[model samples]
Target chain A: MGGGGEVIDNKQVILKELVKGAPKESDMAVKTSSISLKVEEGSKGLVVKNLYLSVEPYVKLRMKKFEHPDFSSFTPGSAMDGFGVGKVVDSGHPEFQKGDLIWGIVGWEEYSVIKNPGSFFKIHHADVPLSYYRGILGMPGMTAWVGLHKVAAPKEGEYVYISGASGAVGQLTKLGFDDAFNYKEEKDLDAALKRCFPEGIDIYFENVGGKMLDAVLLNMRLNGRIAACGMSAEHNLEEPEGVQNLRIIIHKRIRMQGFVVFDYFPQYSEFLDDVLPKIREGKIVYLEHITEGLENAPAALAGSENVWKQVVSVSRE
Target chain B: MGGGGEVIDNKQVILKELVKGAPKESDMAVKTSSISLKVEEGSKGLVVKNLYLSVEPYVKLRMKKFEHPDFSSFTPGSAMDGFGVGKVVDSGHPEFQKGDLIWGIVGWEEYSVIKNPGSFFKIHHADVPLSYYRGILGMPGMTAWVGLHKVAAPKEGEYVYISGASGAVGQLTKLGFDDAFNYKEEKDLDAALKRCFPEGIDIYFENVGGKMLDAVLLNMRLNGRIAACGMSAEHNLEEPEGVQNLRIIIHKRIRMQGFVVFDYFPQYSEFLDDVLPKIREGKIVYLEHITEGLENAPAALAGSENVWKQVVSVSRE
Candidate 1:
């Protein structure tokens, strides 16, 4: 075996305990452990060196214990798993080989042995920044696409409103949406929405729930559609805020639907084909707030204020 | 012209003033006025002898002044207009002939000349009680059909929950839905829902809204659908109650849609074709709370409690 086959020191961001309310930096611990940098014989796993880890708002939902069977909570004293860009160091799987760059659900560590590498998408376009796989070219990007085009099915000249218009999902939504607003800056969300859309919102790309959703409901036009992508505003709350104006949904004949991105994976290639050219031509703008080391990831993920997009860089190409 | 064409005393229920909150009997006054039972010479209208007037919760929305353009309030001293079954006494419109039975928007009066008879639907099936045209075979019936089958799209063996399950709309829903419960009797709605549907609700026919909607949201299964038919509970309130569990919509991947029966009018004949046979086979049970005479209509409409379907019987056939 080559010298590169030697055991390496792996740094991982471990969940110290199940989080309560908003996550804190203390809820996570950075641990260093030794790992063999070689794939075991007869194994169908890919040993990947994680290059970039996406810090997503939905990951917060996985930190708490809940009876929801669809989502599994992050195990205490183990590396947290999320969407990340990685390079395969060793592989026993047919689809992936050594040095193949891929992106999918991966551990928040320097290196991880992904047993089921079927979820991972091999990166074909290396011309763009590899980190783009974590944000604009990853699951979040596809979520914005499917939610807007498939669920909402917005028509031309229709008023579209997007909450969390500065966050990761929101930023991606801005590419397709005609009008966008940062909900945090608005004093009266209903008034602001009314000003932006005098007639009323025809389509609302909902990322933040609670007061934002309540306000959106009041301003919806007749036959308005709401594509609920995420509820970041209600995720950390012990008791989520009450939405009062839901009755407006009846008056306006609105259709509100919630969807997860996992269902839209089959359209990933189609999305890439449509988006890659626009990104290359500078028609689409992508931003990332990168934290340099694994040790700083906890603070960056838990309490990064006013950031456009949060990502943790564990290793370089 | 026949002797019946002579000017006759029309008993009309006039709105004294715009109603606030829950309507009261005092808000309306029964007045007698002279009117010719004949349409104008060249105008397209019909002179109708009102048989049965339907009392609906949405008619309350018209009692208050709102900027909503789709509906207009009843004039302070004019007869209130609502859905009713009538016999055409005279007609200038080609669609109607003398003595033709019909159902549509009509005044809360014994005899009146309708300027716009365009909205009327001809009653072909006379074997069923004409009063059934106001409840089980009319707008409320269509509401239940469109809401359950078209919007909610319930599958066989799917758990269906209907709020306001004892009301007119709910009664019609029970004809299609296997499991139905009156939310008023259940002290703990969540517990009641859990007992009714241990696996969680797949379809919810929303009628009451407010607190009931909040409770239903918590028990919705993944990919659940809610057809918002009415919000009678919130219609009377000055300030509608806030719904706290809307975030569950995201977790459960729910679709909630609000619809009006007017949009489903084109499918009326189609709906009747499907529902008429069921009624003839004694498979569908119809209930009516008949309030005799135009004088007692106000108290009957505004104060009738525990009544399944409230109908103002204006004239005998």
Candidate 2:
């Protein structure tokens, strides 16, 4: 081993067991263990101190056992892993060196040793807040960009309705959508959508599925497009709600497409180039609710229903 | 009006009233009416002798009162109009002339005056059976063509499933698609789809929606595409059955699109050019159930459940 260093205490938020329905704080535990800080000679491994951990709605889906390749379940007694920002403590990887800031999949812990750092992207723009990697410049931001620009392909002046407008990705909907709504506040989603879009919705950025999807289907215009981003409403439910108004899609000639942000990882550089300048110029505003320390990650994730982006800060530097 | 020759007695199938649920033979009445076979000068009108009228499943939708621009309700006490083959007896339009074979919207009557023949397409290829205009060369054919070739756009060897395989458009599904099934024969749609597509369905031609759509949603593969062609099961029901498996669309990254054949009307000539030779070479086999006379049109339309393509012959020649 090249950079063999003294062992240090590492605390990780571990999943006690596979969760069903709504996840509770008792489902996870913060355990501390000693770890050697070193990188094997020829193995392109990276030792990173996790700076911030992102709490996303999809994490709830992963908490339950799923056969889907996209939403693989977390192993019991293992540290929960998701998109996070980290600083390289030690590296054997050619692309990454010590002290380099990177963002990708990382464990919810004080430090994570990545066997393969190929998937990680180097944080080039350091002038902006490093926490932006967890919210605005990271997975959630790319989701809104890809779903709106690529999947929906909305036109100028078209009426766009975004469901779950208070989530991390949903908040970023302010980038291009004509109208955004907090679906929780509406007594009748169909009525609210009708009032916002008098003619009808041309594009629907769907984050909250179930009853919201049914309502959007009823209010869609002719040849409307829908981007099926996520279903936060159905995430915690064992049995999701039924959608009734799909027949309207036939009458209106609507197109609904589903996509994952990871599918567009190759275009992350392009996304960064396009969005970084916008962020710097104050065109896009990012709101984050940061919870300090790795011990608090479990509660932050469980109670992040109203928060736009719940980012747990593991270290200040 | 040079061709104002004869005032002939025309037998017409008139709609008694707007129908709900399943239509009945009693909903229509065969009445005799007089009409002069003439086109007014400088009016760009034409006098057509109806040869054959197509009995499509969508005609049932028109029987009910709907506010949708596409599926307009049929007027009470008026001759029901639909796609048909006709011979231009008299013409003032530049495109159509006397005795020219044409196919377009025509009433369920022997002879009629068309004030706007601009929508009519002149049949240049008279070599094919004229009845083909009511089946393969008509609206149903175009529906299958546009939905498959243009909308779904399935690739080679992809697992394709077609519901309602006995309908007019579904019969034409033999042109493309890896597998086909009559939803009527299948008891458990989910098991049937699993038996047909073990891995998963890449593209689904959704003709019979309702529960069939729910089952197909579960069997859809990652990045699957669905062409929402029709929902015969829901069309009859006053309240449609809610689709429960729409959340699967988000997990599978499925794209479902709805389309109308009229949107592709401008491309009909292109469709004829593509499909004409395939029919001439006997590559495509068309099955038609011919009902003689306009008086039986109502019965043929009402009881066309088992029939592939029901063509009501107003006049053989």
Candidate 3:
């Protein structure tokens, strides 16, 4: 192990170029570089040794060249940043100290110097798998919880429909969903939704947007609630598909709302308190496709897979 | 006048055929039918002389032949029913008496036997124009108030954008809006919205959907609220235009909700209590294009005129 401020080799995954329509593995390359394992003095920075990196579709959105205040595009010739589990190697902040386990935004590299440690959440409970922080107990899980409990606010026995039911957030929401089917397998999405929900959907956890959203709009019951978490289907396209059934919103008195997981960061501790016990008691089921090593991250993210989560293990503690 | 159950000629606006794309004057015809100007014995019904009939865009939606539980399409070759101000000539209902001014769903004929008098709201305050019962004090007005105050729940000084800003409900909402522009005048809707709302819109009263909705989606601020009151622009078209910018809902964390006025019927008296005073004090602005006689009713509803409310005066007194 390197001494306090000694420079060491840092293996990083670099975004080679801005992605256009769809992200390709060729757009990212693994590069080795030397970095001083030191937090800048007087700066509230933490030198984190990234252990598990979450591969999310939103990262691909950041890979695109765009100018918007909401999302800052990832810079070319730099390591792509995303949600990850990390150990603090060095800390310049009072709250965090060396060897503290945390989860937040981190670079796709062996080591990342988080300048603003305020965004990071300290790992309070470790009874569950540490990798769970990157999936079920982290951003995606928090998203599902917030979208369901806070946004959609479904009543008991209400018909709940979920698109992208194979993803991280979708899988964790098994308790609420009555019927599940692969949207890809259906030749007619509207017909499939009708078949699944004969009475029409009361609560729709919207993850896959575009055509799915269009079909769901037609099937939504009166005063139905749609919590739009993500639009994974349209994110990769240069020109997103137009939704044709928006008029149904008025006809059915639907409440379609969109939300981001980061907005519910204040309730993370509350979420952890509620979900941790459920997970430990075998009440909650979480699945992940964990790929070992940083080299596989590009393939894992770029390749289409029917997995709950695509997590890349950089360095297992 | 006939003493009791004498048969009277009822001049009616009958939907000649189910309208396909756009409603033409030819689709509706003025017909006369003889009806008893008396309620049946031991029935909770009121024989009403229809005074003012409101020409609404939703009535056009009902012109189409389709089966949906939410809305009942107007039966072809029958007297079309909509919001109207009427006076009770004969009453079998205990709550209602002769000469009581009322506003409710009434047939587009001179005299209507309202079977469901429970749906009707008695007009207690008549200091303001009785035609206001067909507009500013009626369904569309209730819709606007509910959408803005109840659904969107905008804060003071929040950027409020209203499309179809010259309609019945739209004209009545002059109190809240700061910027007003005709959507038809703008060459590019997105640019127009951007020019008007440089800071981006916070509350959007969505009356015109389709392309206007697409443009508004791009110009919405973070955590914006969209109150879907009506979609007048897309109602006439056989194929409604697809909204392409719905992803902005997720990016901006927007809440777009749809509501029908009937859903808030419980709040009708409350709405009237609030708005009636404002109208009496000349605080609320209401404009209407009143076309006299049942023969001109079809033309008024069909013609594209820049007016707040299109009301047919069936019987002034």
Candidate 4:
């Protein structure tokens, strides 16, 4: 209920062990103790009460530092880091003010002191449920916006095929498929694609690019474009079904391109301009699978390993 | 060598038996016939003494009906087709007149009659070797130009890595890395990249993507762009070498995109204008591996199987 209570000091959850396989609940410990929850005066930082924590598939990528990409290795003794909607209790940066609710990189606990706090985004649209900040209004939204509109560039009546359609990015990607989904699975790929669009898909937003990519290749209209955003379905599997349909790239003259979100961040403002309105107008929708509580964060991400657009809600909100 | 008998009926080579495996000289046949060394009155199509044939690896792909893309496959029992430069014997089109020189897609015979041609650039610079049309002034030139200037968008002093460095596209791509290539490969991939760059590779034009890609990944500068035009190595190998360094794409935030010549054809004029001056000014070097004589066309291409930028010459200046 967000009821105010005496400030709890130095109380935190500590990760007691590094997880090997799917992380278990025993991997983390919640503690009650004594530490100041105040932001240092004059420092470019903000102390925030994390109101809603984000659970995402990428955090799993961080859990084990193998090589390729975004997040730092999680320290064994420290708390986990993620995106959350937080209310700033105090701020030293000019861009942030006390009581300003923002969304950005933060910790798994109830509160976090974030340096370079200016990087955090101040929530401007307060009308939407604040928890949406952890998802539809935040990172996941940015992912869909960047991948679909920017990378794929879907056109009206364009046959669009999105992998992970049931997940966060998938659902959001479908918002572009039709005003309503006539969504169905085709038993035979060609028939399925034909069923999806007898006219043939002009743009394929390839969030999944193994078997799904193969299917879409056959159904693609001449001069089709494929935006290779992710390979989530096979990321954990040892062998993704081989992409035999790559030959379609030549036959149908397809243009398949791959891009990571980080490469397009410079266009973030432009992306937001295009997406924020759609989001506000309900022209775009996002599907999020949320797991509750910070203690369940590891398990939630592990559980979400096979899914797309999964989220974790760690706070009261 | 410049002398030949007159009354010599024009001799030509044609694809005889479309093969399932590597092409054989017997797969192509030569025949001689007589034609008026003249043109039909009021014919717009130009006929010429075809001088040089630009042999490209893509031609091998075209020879086989099995499709992968960025190029069209040659029809069975037809003359092979590729980029060539020739002199006009007869001019029927307004775009050309007697003795007017042109270069572009033409048949794989001694002399070809081209109709409804696109951008048959008038050879205004005779001082430049006409054979240049098969290489720098021709189709491969445009592919490299579009992939580099348009796709890769390379910057000066940025480390640029070109796989198949000895080939037509590779030579030009490495030329893009001009003056930046150092002699050593460094241990720290980034530093190794810097050694090649000391300035950092802003662009990578990827013609080969197995070990070469693995090596290029180490040398890629932050936010480097890759123009993934071809993967000849993997295209032929039953089992392509695993690229373990793919994670580098995420780490360096690199951008790798692929292309086909036909897709960029609409931009042909823009390409010529943007790149022609560079050619005229000697800012760019054009390389061609040419095989002489129509009878030797198959062997010309076959000889360069393991080599780069090798071309089979059908005719010459």
Candidate 5:
């Protein structure tokens, strides 16, 4: 613990209560506290000065608290946690150094002291944008890559449909699929499969479910594979509409699977091996929408409906 | 068409104006036709005396031209098409002859001239109940087998969740999945995934979406897979509710896909190789809630609210 260092109180955004439909400003409250940024002497912990925080649609989940046998829901009045890019201002662990720039699980505040650094990765490519840690270079990037390559396994000339296509992960993944697999993007989701995939949709990286999924279903080829990615379109609706054309699943003998990033975390290095060099070589195009300051963090994460890569730079860069 | 055959008008159940939500008896009308059963010499079609017709929940889709694209929705006032077992009364096609047992796509009537004799597969497994083809060995049965094995691709010990678990296709598919993959039976549904899948669900054959899908999303393993098979749960709901855990898709990387059977026709023979032996042996179990009579065909195809697979046998034998 740095006893003599000037300790600024940590400010955080917390859910005021379970949100209803689209969130309003009242759904959250920003709380501040003068807490020491130090792990216990013997604890395997790292104190980080958060340089960047990712603004993602997934945060809406923290607004609800539901009991699950396998998992716990987000409780009200709790600090929001997500992937953060930070510098090791102080470290009590051997794996991290004081000056190292690392990205991992952290809070939406100026600084955070994390104990269970389960999947945190040290930012090896500091020469590139650190914000990339949250995007093409990071979670959203890996989300698109893993889903398209690993789960969906798109082959060249296969019809690939992405729902939340304009969103951060959606856009990057579309390019990823386009880049990795020789795919010609077809706009008429249904007709695209008919035109591009005369044989039919071989692989689908599903990001949007509703109308997009409906259109894609009609053209899915036999033995088609779909990676169930996300449903950003149906996220805020009161009652999610039942998807039509699911009967094709049985008829076409399709394969649809969902994946969590952590499930592929063990392959993170492998992900880096395949991705990082391409990113550095400028063979990849990355998009990042950065929102500066903590006061703007809540609204930025709330009000802004960005269709692509978005991030909240919580601290003074 | 036969010119001298007894041209007595036979009755057929016809859907009138489009019905909303679950179909009712009033949604359909019975009309008589004087069309002869004899096939035209040049038509290359088989005159099938329908011994059994397969009425499945998917027929409900034909009740109206849903905005979400699927197979051509049933034409109003037309004899709706479905899979059925029949005896060939006569044939212009060289492959079919009188007294041959055949089943495939046919009209919902006693005598139907199946234009495409190729669609009908000659039933060799007639030793088992012919009605089994109306389900387990037929389209619904193929649906269950292929849907579970092909679409779901359930890994052993993966938490496999089926929504319309009690229906004929749902039950049959559930049985197949249970036999093919290791899954815990969960009927309470509201809390089934939670109680049965404390470690979280790995694969979800989504026959029922809406709230059940929402809850299932909450308990999914990080890289869980979902075969977006059917959403019978919210089929009737005008406006579906927003799923809370949808955003978990990005974090967990879940895949949700919709499909159809038309594309897999090539693999029909191969699918039989995997499933028929299972049926021939007492290894697989199937059940159908039979709604007797062609007069009740509309009501049967309408299917009950949240009820499992119900079959209406229009043929005597």
Candidate 6:
């Protein structure tokens, strides 16, 4: 059925059970299974060998059982699904053929057979690292672009403050923002914001919520804009920390909006057109913390302090 | 330089000192003074006989020693300044004449000399109740219209929720909102919101913040909008209550904005053009709790349960 094709063993990181609070390595298990490198006849599907898998904070949310209509929880004993860069091994689909490089949502396994290949995006640029699709050139990059440009609508000379200034989203925000600070180092976030932005912040890219948000509210200038990108500080907590200074929203006339990356998927090509040149010009920089094996993916996803973007290299290629 | 020359005894409401928490009647004192119904020669000022004075919640904020640049605190032993309707007794300014009806920021006294008549709005419609200028046709009315139409931007069939649904801002919100309920009556605000908005709330006119806001955050629909008008609950509290469920904003893609009425002052004439007819046709109903005399003004401002728009009728027209 194929030219020099053979059966192979697939190594996958599976969710052992639903996690309650902060995810632990014990909640997941690495397993090995055998699969034929061939797509079934009369089926519109393609077999892919996953090269790199992304470990994002949002994936921890999917590890728990929740009634989210848009996202389903990872089933126990099944391989976790996440954003990944892959190579098409075999295809019965009209759009994709063998050896086509693609990136999108894929299983956290060495090889996966995707029934609906509609979600996949074909990789055209061979010069750029394929792993970039797992970080800066992928979802996180689009998130930062849409949030700052469309949502926050930042203007030059305006003061900007971003929490979690070393993360995937915050690093991207630093390129556009006037001044960026790492919230982790600050003893008092309010005092820190005051020192950085004495005139007050006009735009705030909210990544870490809780105390950071409370402090930012105190330093916001009139008609300030806050792009609520993520609440990583509250994600692991059983009860999210209370924000008390929300009344300042009225005093400052602030507009705070929360958005999802999926909503901006249609503008992906336009985003690429703008960002690719910036990348080539060295105007944009990306930092990634990569884990080599599927066995260590759970630790990578659980995250570490000072880590930028957590990425898992599923295969050597 | 007087039309009706007379030295009238002015009954004035003066602040005794700065208030700590919820205002008491004793915090303000009623004092009597004399003012000539005449404007000094060469001075660009006018003398007015106060008819009605508005008792708004924001007046309480000015009672304390807060350093608000735009609005100064009520100085001890001095007459409080607030929105009121009056008839011009004498004028030195080119725009004003004797017997002209006007409304704007005026002293909480029977008769006073207004140095700057520039901020005042002339009452063109003699048919409408002059007291309406202090409440519905004035500040509170503008607040509701701008918050709903401009901020929330509600569409037809979209669910709307309003906390403190019996106050000045809340009553006006009822006319435009599909359904309304008082936050005071509900033992569990989240359950009440669930009962009222089974499909989930699309727009929330936040009047009472703190715990009520926490509850509303739970019941918000995807892409929901929250018009943060006032935080009455937190105004009197020593330490404002904390809101814990803000992470729901990210999950639901919600937009929460806070604005001041002064920003929308330019649109006042446009607002009157739309709302005046609704009042004439009896399509809109307004409730006013009128408290007679400057002696009772402090009690009225302290706020009473089941009261809508509190107005101090200083002089019977």
Give the candidate number with the greatest DockQ: 2
lDDT of 4 by residue, A74-120 (tens): 77777777778889876767888888989987887777778787567
Which ten-residue region of model 4 chain B has the weakest summed lDDT?
A: B1-10
The predicted structure with the larger TM-score, 5 or 6, is 6
| Shift in Å, residue B219, candidate 5 | 5.7
Model 4 iRMS (Å) reads 5.0
A-chain TM-score of every model: 0.91, 0.92, 0.93, 0.79, 0.84, 0.89
- lDDT scores of the candidates, listed in order: 0.81, 0.82, 0.83, 0.63, 0.67, 0.81
**Model 3 C-alpha lDDT per residue in residues B223-314, reported as the tens digit of each score:** 99998865343454466688788877886899999877778889887887788788777788777889999889999889845344889999
Measured against the true two-chain complex, the DockQ scores of the candidates, in the order shown, are 0.66, 0.74, 0.72, 0.21, 0.22, 0.67
Decreasing DockQ order of the candidates: 2, 3, 6, 1, 5, 4
Worst 10 residues of 5 chain A by lDDT: A175-184
TM-scores for all candidates: the values are: 0.92, 0.94, 0.93, 0.79, 0.67, 0.92
State the lDDT of candidate 6 residue by residue for A1-317, as single tens digits. 33235778888889999988778888888899877788876778889999888887667778887655467788989999888899999998899999999998899899998889987888887577788886777887788788888899989888877666676666565565556556667788889888888999898888878888999898999999998865243354465788888888986899999988778888988888888887787788767778898878878887655334878998877
Model 4, span B1-317: residue lDDT tens: 11122334666666775566676667776776554545455555666677777666666656665545345566766677777777887766776777887787677777776765565666666677677767765666766777778777866555556655556565554544454432234344445555556655667776655555667767767778877655243365334444545545544656656566656777877876776777678777766566668878777766656334555566555
- Candidate whose lDDT is highest: 3
Provide the TM-score of the second chain in candidate 2: 0.93
**Which has the better lDDT: candidate 5, or candidate 6?**
6
Q: Which RMSD values do the candidates have, in order?
A: 3.1, 2.5, 2.7, 5.8, 7.5, 3.0
> Candidate 6: where are CA atoms >4 Å away?
A1-6, A19-27, A61-72, A174-180, A231-234, A293-308, B1-6, B65-69, B176-179, B231-234, B306-308
For every candidate, the chain B TM-score is: 0.92, 0.93, 0.92, 0.76, 0.83, 0.90
- Point out where model 4 deviates above 4 Å: A1-13, A40-44, A92-95, A171-200, A209-317, B1-8, B36-46, B68-81, B115-121, B170-200, B230-234, B237-251, B262-299, B305-317
Q: Per-residue lDDT tens digits of candidate 2, residues A1-317?
A: 24568688999989999987777889999999866678766768999999998887767667887666555788999999988999998898889999999998899889999999998989999999898897778888888888888899978888877776777566665665556566678899889888888898899888767788888888888899999865353454456677777877887899999887778889998989888998898878777889998899899988877434889999998
lDDT of 3 at A6: 84
User: What is residue A127's positional error in candidate 3, in angstroms?
Assistant: 2.2
Worst 10 residues of 5 chain B by lDDT: B175-184
The C-alpha interface RMSD of every prediction is: 1.6, 1.4, 1.5, 5.0, 6.1, 1.7
Distance from true location, Cα of A267 in model 3, Å: 0.7
